[model samples]
Target: MLVDVRNFHITGKEFERRLDEVQITVNKNSVPNDTEKPFVTSGIRVGTPSATSRGFKEPEMAKIARWMGEAARDFDGSAAQVKAEVNALCEAFPIYQ
Candidate 1:
């Protein structure tokens, strides 16, 4: 998933504020990082293919989505618990031998 910050018409300060809302392990990059464009981007990119390939199913995905949504709305730096949960989940289904 990709969130285009430009569409929000938010100032830099607002961007900063919004940044604190998420604690998900997503990659945040500027415009150039997105597609080699000259414009500066305030976008967020998230991927779950790897997890899916590792055998993460719908229930796991739903949990992850909830975490992402909560993090993106009003994160309070309590993602450690969520991280632990994710780690446990991943450990339950290893991708490598």
Candidate 2:
């Protein structure tokens, strides 16, 4: 999934940083400019293979996405809350066993 950060009023890197703070992993990528230089990126790339392997269904994924958006919108105000939610979700879906 690609999350466009333009609407969030922050750069893709910034958004990715906030997600990282909340224990969400995503990549900051952008469409290359004419010179093939990534001068600015407006979107973050989110991968779901890990989550899918951990038995995360649509509902859980949706919750995660919401957490990401919340972090992007207000990391200072929501990082702790989002992190707790992420931990809870991960605990419910153990990677092993």
Question: TM-score per candidate, in order?
Answer: 0.56, 0.88
lDDT of 1 by residue, 1-97 (tens): 6655555554223443443443235555454344424233466555778877888888988887776554444445645665666678777888895
Say which candidate scores most in TM-score. 2
Best by lDDT: 2
What's the C-alpha lDDT at position 42 in model 2? 78
lDDT score for candidate 1 against the true structure = 0.58
Residue 94 in model 1: lDDT: 87
lDDT string for model 2 (56-85, tens) is: 999998899799878877788989989999
Q: Tell me the spans in candidate 2 whose CA falls farther than 4 Å from its real position.
A: 31-40
Model 1, poorest ten-residue lDDT window? 10-19
CA lDDT of each prediction against the hidden true structure: 0.58, 0.82
Q: So what's the TM-score on candidate 1?
A: 0.56
Runs in model 1 deviating more than 4 A are 4-24, 29-40
